[model samples]
Target: MATLICEASGDWEKAKCVIKDCGSLKSVSDGSVSLDSSATTFGSTATVSCSVGYVPKAEKITCKESGVWEEAQCIIKDCGSLPSISDGSVRLDSTATTFGSTATVSCNIGYDPSVATIRCQASGAWDIAACTIKDCGTLPSISDGSMRLDSTTTTFGSTATVSCNIGYDPSVATIRCQASGAWDLAACTIKDCGTLPSISDGSVRLDSTTTTFGSTATVSCNVGYDPSVATIRCQASGAWDLAACTIKDCGTLPSISDGSVRLDSTTTTFGSTATVSCNVGYDPSVATIRCQASGAWDLAACTIKDCGTLPSISDGSMRLDSTTTTFGSTATVSYNVGYDPSVATIRCQASGAWDLAACTIKDCGTLPSISDGSVRLDSTTTTFGSTATVSCNVGYDPSVATIRCQASGAWDLAACTIKDCGTLPSISDGSVRLDSTTTTFGSTATVSCNVGYDPSVATIRCQASGAWDLAACTIKDCGTLPSISDGSMRLDSTTTTFGSTATVSCNVGYDPSVATIRCQASGAWDLAACTIKDCGTLPSISDGSVRLDSTTTTFGSTATVSCNVGYDPSVATIRCQASGAWD
Candidate 1:
């Protein structure tokens, strides 16, 4: 009874029983594991196995009688050798090739790798067929230039050198083929003429300093100079056309009919002026001429002078001895109506103007005297077109203040009239009288009030509107009444008009010594007449007591009294009436 036990439990009876050779062995390719007969005993053998693509290791092991089992060693399936690439090479990850392992593929310096990495599969083969080469597209064309490549083929990582043709420049010097299968080429541009040509005694204006084909340049001459050629253009050969400038000059001056010219210098150059003048009795139509850069002189002429017609005299007639009133002619003047000329004749001069000193105005004597006014002349000697102002004496005014001296040797007095405010206006309750007999404009009248009246306005004047301003007379009234002690006054009327009276009365316990007052016409009031009166001692009472409301009992005062209790009395109160005795 040799019984086997579980390794986990040291006792044989406690271990779980397992049958020998009850399960099939794990399968392997190109290899095998050994077993004892059909039934396995306490000691059985197990061998590791492998196929052609996988490597085998760790040979035989015995199975235990317990449920515990031993492992057989068989490595991963091998992919054998790496596949060859056309323009690339493969690098294996490890010495032992197996599933889930990787190999990297690379190409030459100018070539691109189509597959960077290849993995091994469980079927014992690599995932990729082979590594391929990448080609970059053809290079792009460059204007005005050509390119030189390092290699003839357009492949990845290849460089091309770019060069411009003569008189041209390249935007970029070098380009390369990128890994993305595209070739880049540098651009080229044509060269430009640096700057425009400079000009002497002139200025050059160019459309652009880059003076490429079809560029234009304009030339302008300085002051006192002119350009031979006004414009020039830059040719395609990178040169500017020829242009020149010369000094400016003006030709001979033009001749004048009746005028002579005086030039600063004999030569007629630009900016020269010629002064022209006429003979003694003549005037020049144009005063000066100037030499211009256009080789021409400004136009000018001279003409003779003649006085036109003779002037006419106002308020008189004149006769000309000659038929035409030309230069050096005379005309005689005669009086018409009441007009007369200060000078006998007038002459026309050669200066195209008449001699006006002989055109004198007639004289008018002193202005006529106004009835109640005086005249002030603008000039002491009256002449034509002169004026005078008229004024009246005090209490008088003139209808017109201004008078004019006419050409007929007389003053115009038609509109002049003396204004009189007839007999100063009468006023009620007052008398008004003027200061002078002439009651015209600008006159004053004094006013006086009656016995019981007052002059509201003291003086009045005669105005220019022919009306008299009268003084106002109003009834006189007195102001507030005078004060009095221990008494009061009452006016007969609300207002203290002249001749109005006020009555005075003393208060209780006093008498009025003076009783009345009056308002006077002079706006003053009569003296207050309210003197106080004293009363003697009060009377005594019999069979009772007496009480006086005031200490002194005068007229119009009273006292209270009471008889002894139950005693009869003649009266309960005693009065100091106006009778000067107690009642």
Candidate 2:
């Protein structure tokens, strides 16, 4: 019968035998063959088990009766634990996950320690770790809304009110704090907000105060504005401040948009055209025409250098009759310097058979010729397209002249015809039409641009005769591009093939967009210059440029990039943009 060869054979090679029947014995627990000093053969059995956390050798055991050594089997283990996270948290319970047990963690209510992560071990013990995370936010500031808030802001999550410091109306008059700790508006609305008071800061509100003669409150005003009516605290302050019309702003003056006027008085001269229209009641057709500046009007025809054409003589003025006068007949009176404003005078004859012309050719004087200057005519009788050339006796470039004359036997008074034409008007994208042959200061010189040229660039002004000034123009339409989305990538791979997930995005912040771009088909490559942005306000550059590969919420970070010849970073140098947006 077969007997037990070796109960447990691990160390010694030889074993004792209680030999029996036809077969041999084998061990599953731990097995091995053994050899004795007597060189005798014996049946043996070997059994084996492995270290603690490791799986032991397989089920079979090896035994050699004829003195041969059998092979051994076992495997080592590496099973790693939980990994570290970006938030500084750690996890360890990966072992014994075999049949799988559950794992758990917690952040004590009060201890709000950043993170609390844990994993279950083979022994069922849980290993927990702590980590830290940061929170980001903004400051209490007004945006481009109903409030003209100061862009200056404190930190994120603060508060502010709506009051334009000075010279501005509060777009929104009130504001409140929000949950995010930042200042926001529950409701924004318009109130009786006039422009900023023309007073110093910190001044109290005078809305409830009454208006009295001499009584006044300091006030602040907006740009381009000034007090048209003085505020006076007359009797005990009664009604709110009130304003009234004063004649000081009105006179023989041209009506400036019916109320607002440039206070420079008596500026009208002969040929100075100003329209006459009265308020609703006053009949404009029956209104008396007079010189705006001096109140001196032409009872006779006002003098002009050379009426581009003959002045259309109206009623009760000079006429070209024999006993009447022939316009350019015998003594034609003309002035060449410092002339009086045009005025009409009635020549009371013995027989009141009224003869009317702009002015009398007989009361006129001889015209003193001028070169590059004006020749004021005494009568309304005139010709068009007249030329006067002026030259200095010596060597001065003052090549200028002046001509004026008072109508009706008044001495040949020269008029205010200035001949100092400093510079010639220059032509640009557009052309110009000088109102007079003699271009003067403050003349309205209208300049137009070419079809595609931008007009808001510069205003045209005529000095004297001719001088063209250069105006820097804003960018017109040249070319532009739209925002493009090339999308993203997981890793810059061996075949940086911009795989299915690779993304690229480009959006212009300026007016002109990018044109075209291309890239070669190799692995891990840079861009082929998609397109360049046009610079300048004229060019209209897009505010935000472009982004790519990953997401980035940082400011001014450009995704389009070029690496320095030798610079290499662990992560892709090109960063994605962070759309600075929050709820």
Candidate 3:
């Protein structure tokens, strides 16, 4: 030992230089520290290391002369940074780059990662992970449509063009592959044009069962009709082109001789009818004709008319200039002996009818007027052979009973004359009064009796025989005078005629009511029966009482008076006199 111990104190001292040692190291956060050697002596070296997933700040620590190892610490490790993906991001367990750290790779939607997670290597480097774009499968087939891809690959953002097949519509023009690895919907629908317009009085025929675009249709007219258009087309816009069908027209109708036509409708189209009207003397062969499909009207005609024989007129006959009764014939009218013709001639008209002609009786002028008479006609009109009767008025006579009208329109001579009556006859004991100065038929004579006579008839009238009727007056005679109960009569005339009177005398003790009764023209005596005479009661005396000889104080009755105690009566007895006086 080339030790310097020989020079040191001779005691062979064992003192020697000791190596510096370092103490245990602190543990690392989220990791642990380790050493290559457990020695912590000065001048000795130890390797500094971290636990799993961790790393040391220094490689090794050596014991220094100061007995302190060099400053060294173990901390969490960090993977520097994960490798970036094309469309992804990375997340680490911690911000460490040393060992045991893991990084997770998250691919963006529609992308795929090479690995889900990567670890930091023990050498302080991170494992590699990557992201790649996802692939979407091929697009599905679209109904009623076809598809065309821009590229054969179907990745995100890839697009495909779409088109509808025949009779269909592609609602979408193109579809894209989405980030979710699916393609956009291809909305394809069947093409359609709604119902077509109907043809009026016509029909429409379609080429195909469907009314879709590109379909064709034919337009046709019904019987008796014509179409304006023959066909129509469906447009790409799912609509049909404008078209219409209309009716056919027939030309104007032909003219018929002696007749005219009238159309049933305003148009001369097929199925229309026209009525025929003939002229006055013409007859139509047919009533109506119809328009045909051949653009013309059916045949029609008119013919001359035939009129029947003329009718017979009462009391007259008709003579024809021509024997034929057809149109344009002429006739003449003739009447009987006393009749006349209204018209001389008549002609047949084109309407199968004859012009009017009449035979009428001859008319006579008014009859001559008479002084006081009138004439009565048997018929309303003064025609030929008519009769008229002449009548006299109240005071006149007719010269003729009946007269007739002559063929020369003259009436027979007839006259009305005043009636005549003979002189009025005298009436016995009576006078006559005439109504008028002249004594004509219907004259009146009124008769009146004398003082003592009565008229048998009061009036007389002149007769149609031209004579005055006879009248007589009779003497008014009264019957026997009425007898009174107790009286007698003395008549001046024995016959008791009108104006005669009788003297009425009461019987004994009775007095006549009237001195005389007269006979009146009414055949009755103007006298009442004789009544008995009555005397009233006697007057009272100054102081006496009276006594009656009979119960009644009538004619020939007596009365007696008695005086009062000191009274005296002028007379003691009294008698009622016939004159109703007291005696």
Candidate 4:
């Protein structure tokens, strides 16, 4: 047997004998641990003891030779009964009240809780708390009134009474605190006085239909009457201030020079009228006067018998016979250069009014006509400053485009003259002809081009100025002809002009269906283009072979016939013709 060497570990280092121990047990929350023997070595035993309201996981544990104690721990104990509340009940989150458990308190309708929830602590006890009644803030104030609280406490279900001051009424007599911790609506309003006061010969207007305090009433008298006070207020006592309206009176009518007064009514009180009349040719300032609401009569007066100066006439002058504009006065009238007067004199009428004369604009006769043109008037009447528009013939123009009627009853001198576009411009291959004998304004001319030639413009006109509007005649020629495939073309004329012709000729293996084409007046060939004529493929002959001179069998293409061994064709060779046939 081999001798074994042993080494001490964990709390047994350097000891004479191997001494094992379950190192001091870790303390458990709310619990304690104690060993059976003071010395902790192999086979030692220990007991787990928990604090009040706590329990141990295992009652006893032993230490092993390895210096380790058996697994042991302390757990939280059950907490008995939930917390109490004054005005509430408890609601547990779960039936279990072990560690980390929670419970909530619900207050009665009008109560509240101090804390929302109570939790079971690690000590196996619930946190201390209670529920109490809720409180509401201060009472609401009333406008124009006083409020008195009925209950000493401002909690839910509390109430207050309202009292309005003098001249005001309470909207509600009582108010209460709501469960939401707020007061009900409460208010007071000013008192209202009934209808406004009535008055004789006048009317009263109130600021509002309701005659409440601070309301105003305006007093207005009827015609010919005056009010003692214009406005009054409703007093706090619910009554309007005193006001009165009385009839107005005016004194006697006044006298006027050169005038006589006649009273329309017997009495001179309000609304009385008086008429004033002046001597012949004299006028009263006012026809009648009446007693006004201000307790006085309106002014009445009469002055000298004369008419005011005559109003000035447009484009005319007037001279008064005398310095005064009295009756029987006369004034002479004179017209401006372009004006005419209806009458030569103006007379003052007996009614103290002037008989005015009117001045009219002078009229000019119809406009004069031009040799080869016409004129049209722009205005309905031929009065001064009116204008006439001149229009010339196709070959003429106006010397002066417009003319006006003079102020002296004459028309302005204007005419449409014949244009003198000197001689017609010459053209290379064309000739021009004058339609009129003279080359003045309104003259017309025509241009003619020889065959195969064209003029830029067919006609010419003498412009508004002395010069004529003319254009040169250019030579007319057709554009290039379309190309011919496998063929060539030859022009009948040197230039491709109208009536010109082109002839098409095909190569040895092609032919043209239409040998010739003509150039049209539109500067294009009558035919689109020339094409080669095809004779179709050669016929197959039995026992004989055929050889073609070219790949194509069109137009002049040829084919050689041969005998195979002992066979011979009817014809030795064949040729493609221009008529789309083989011969």
lDDT for model 3: 0.77
CA lDDT of every candidate: 0.71, 0.35, 0.77, 0.80
Per-candidate clashes, comma-separated = 6, 98, 23, 7
lDDT of 2 by residue, 1-583 (tens): 4334443655444556653221233322223333323222333434445443334354334345545434445433333454443434343344443213333343322223343445444443444455332222342344323343334543233334564432224554554433333455433222232332434212223433533323354433332224444442333222235433211111344442222222223535422334444332122332334443333442322221111222344222233323432222222223223332144332322222222234323333345543333454434543222223333322123333423334333333232343343554555556555555545454444556654455553455543443434443232432212233432222222222222122334443212122322222222223322222322111111332233433433333334433455654333333322332210
Model 1 deviation from native, Cα RMSD in Å: 22.2
lDDT at position 3, candidate 3: 66
List model 3 lDDT by residue over 6-72, tens digit each: 5446667467776556777554454444556667666666666556655667777666788776776
By lDDT, the better pick of 1 and 3 is 3
Give the Cα error of residue 556 in candidate 4, in Å: 14
The best candidate in terms of TM-score: 4
lDDT (tens digit, per residue) of candidate 4 on 320-422: 9888888889999998777889999888887888886888998887778777788899978889999989888766667888888988888887665555778
Q: How close is candidate 4 to the true structure, as a TM-score?
A: 0.42
In TM-score terms, candidate 1 sits at 0.33
Number of the candidate with higher TM-score, 1 or 3: 3
What's the CA RMSD for each of the models? 22.2, 43.3, 40.3, 13.8
TM-score of candidate 3 relative to the true fold = 0.40
Error of 4 at 138 (Å): 11
The residue ranges of model 3 lying beyond 4 angstroms of the native Cα positions read 1-223, 226-247, 255-265, 273-289, 300-337, 352-358, 361-383, 386-398, 409-420, 457-471, 482-487, 490-494, 499-583
